[model samples]
Target chain A: MGALSWAALSLPAKPPGLAKASLDRLGESGVAHPVTAVLLNYRGYDTLLEVGVLLLALAGAWSLGRGEQPAENPQSRPLLLSLLRVLLPMLLLAAGHLLWIGAFAPGGAFQGGALLGGALVLLILGGLARRALKRERCLRAGLALGVLVFAGIAAVTMALTGGLLQYPPGAGGALILVIETAAMVSIGLALGLLYLGGQPPEGARRSLLATPPDHA
Target chain B: MIWRSFDWFLLLAIVGLGWRSLNDRDLFRAVIQFIAFGLLAAVAWVRLRAPDVALAEAAVGSGLTGALLLSALARMRRREQQAVPPRTEASE
Candidate 1:
């Protein structure tokens, strides 16, 4: 049966159908990177839906219960703290570089966002950005910003071009950049909050504010 | 070729780590194996000429997932310890 099926299935020759079309029409997306073009222009709806799904997953995780703090964690080791001090800035720089290079290279919002998320996770583990992260209002807004911006762009483009996410003339590059920037921020915050496991307690906010920033 | 052999090794390592992680009795060890699996899978993605995927696999799949798993493992252990009664000499 396996051999029969293999024989029955005809393999595509040279470039596949969509690949040929995509290569021919690559300039229409205006993104130098083929992957970026497909992700943010050719099949942007999927990417938009993906960001929404990620936000939904974070929402589901948050709804579970209040997050419990790690007990007796030696996250404040002098060695780890020092390492974080050096690593944080470099990681943030690399994330920004990745986000910018996505237009012409094999990097994009997801990769950059993941790196940003890693940095955020490090900040959380080191307990350095406790006060910043505690800004629930800002965090919530940032968390929803990706999908909001992406969908907003889609709607705007739809109104202008008569199709969802269809870029208006020469605006594909800038619009993708805007959407990706918002997505990177949202993804990083969402991942950091996911590591937090659930919604933090109300009292913990007051306590964190009282403690000195360098206490960790 | 040397590259072909390396690819075979990579494949073996990925499969072995994946299987071991799934079946391991110890959660901590399993998570470590899972992380190793993810890293190897990232290498495989790179070999397949998908650098974008390779980046995501390494950053999100290995790094974030591993951190999350370890955090959850630590929490589970802490909760279990809290639930169990401490045995004193008198109780014994």
Candidate 2:
């Protein structure tokens, strides 16, 4: 039955269900990336709400693991440490490239930010960077930055254009870039912290020189 | 014809990995299987001509989610060990 259904399915003759006008106006929308234009310009409100949803997820995770300190694994090998030193910077570069190319290609804030988040997780696993409890304020601020920046832009754009997030004709691209950059940073930090499972205690630095666990 | 065969193979791998992960008794093995599923899903997205979704699936779907699952697993293991202290051979 499944094979019959699969065989029956075929691509449409004329690329069904896309608004031709929207495709034509994609370039004029101030971003060459059609997906970006659609996500941040045509449907900016939805993107803003999505960022809020990410924040809500983080909030829920934090509450669930309240007052729990992340357990340290001190058994990171030197080889892994050296590898990460080389790899982390490369990942950051790739992320930056993705963020930049997102203006004209398939990359975007979410993809780039996720790469950064992955790098952060790698750093944590390698014991190079620790999530400190004392830095909760900083973490909180970073988490909120994306939504705040997005909402601020929405309000400002509303004041200027008399409609929410309606960018001025010539200024749309720059505004979207600004919003994407802020969103990328916030998303990266939020995701990385989420992987920690709980807040780290103040002054918990797992140094490279630290002794490995006996099992290692 | 070759491309169609490859697509079928990819589809089978995805299904097989998903089923294995769902049924795996070892939580760690399940997490690894799930990560593999995510990567294959990203490849499927790319084949579908949506590079944007593919990049997202590879990055957030596979990488970050895998890390989250592993950390949660670690925490769970720690809790389990604490709850069930080792019964020494002498005691047994």
Candidate 3:
């Protein structure tokens, strides 16, 4: 999905077409393409590990934003805001393409998603205050839901195939694609919010609601 | 071919920019140079084959941190503006 988006946007520039090349090379044998093999090897476990790194960034960003709830005043303008719109989707596509190509080369799910997360962070900083205003609970629920879905998939795999995060070898390609696609959305959302600077309006309102009334 | 050796050049740029950014005499120049350092660092990540790290570096390094620094610069400018009081004595 990202790769397709990238291709659509990068129309004239036309960065190297790894997907076409990789697809053509599928008719051959072992580790033929350095880029794809680096990405796709071991059904993309390496990519998963790299994604954990971005997860760490999310953790780190989240930790830094404590003790204050910065309110969103819709008045903040081009203070790094407009660029967010232009850069984000392009970054997503680039990351996706890179990760997909990595299935044959050095790109992997983790690296690609991290790039997407990075773009997300840029957007947040550029002042897309969406999640920091009203989307807090829905966003958290989304993160929890992602974990549940991943766990459910793994459990079902274990029940049917006696192993978790495991898919039949012949179906590895399709399975990896499915996992990567799901993970792209799940991981990107968490990391984007983590990098966002402050609490959404609801969380702030909730905290205010939690405070006991001042004693007379 | 030159682009392939982009990693080495990128590292060199990062080191040079980092050193200048940390030690420059002018505070404003130092901050701008720090952003350059980040851009170089991103290039290095690309060379290292970690697009993930590169992207994060670009965002946090240049985007967020850079904005923070620029805000500080703005405040400093306003302070300087106020500090240079109106000509009360006489014109040179």
- lDDT (C-alpha, whole model) for all candidates: 0.87, 0.84, 0.60
Ranking of predictions according to lDDT: 1, 2, 3
Residue-wise lDDT of candidate 1 within A1-216, one digit each (tens)? 788878667555453457777777778787889899999999999999999998998889879987755433446478878898899899989989999999999999999899989998887777676677667778889999999999999998899999989999888899999999999999988887788788754434555358755785
Clashes by residue pair, model 1 = none
Candidate 3 lDDT over A68-123, as tens digits, reads 22334534756555666677778888877865665555555445655665675555
Task: Flag the better candidate by lDDT, 1 or 2.
Answer: 1
Off by more than 4 A, model 1: A1-17, A71-76, A203-216, B86-92
lDDT of 1 at A52: 93
**B3-49 per-residue lDDT for model 3 (tens digits):** 75775677777889999999999999999999988878887878787
DockQ of 3: 0.12
Stretches off by above 4 angstroms in model 3 are A1-128, A145-150, A160-164, A201-216, B1-11, B24-32, B42-92
Query: Which 10-residue span in candidate 2 chain A carries the lowest summed lDDT?
Result: A67-76
* lDDT (tens digit, per residue) of candidate 2 on A1-216: 788777667555567665676688887678988899889998899999999998998888777655334455646377777888799999999989998899899998999899888887777777666544356777788889999999999999999999888898989999999999999988998888787675544453456876657747
Model 2 achieves a DockQ score of 0.83
Name the candidate, 1 or 3, with the larger lDDT value. Answer: 1
Per-prediction tally of clashes: 0, 1, 17
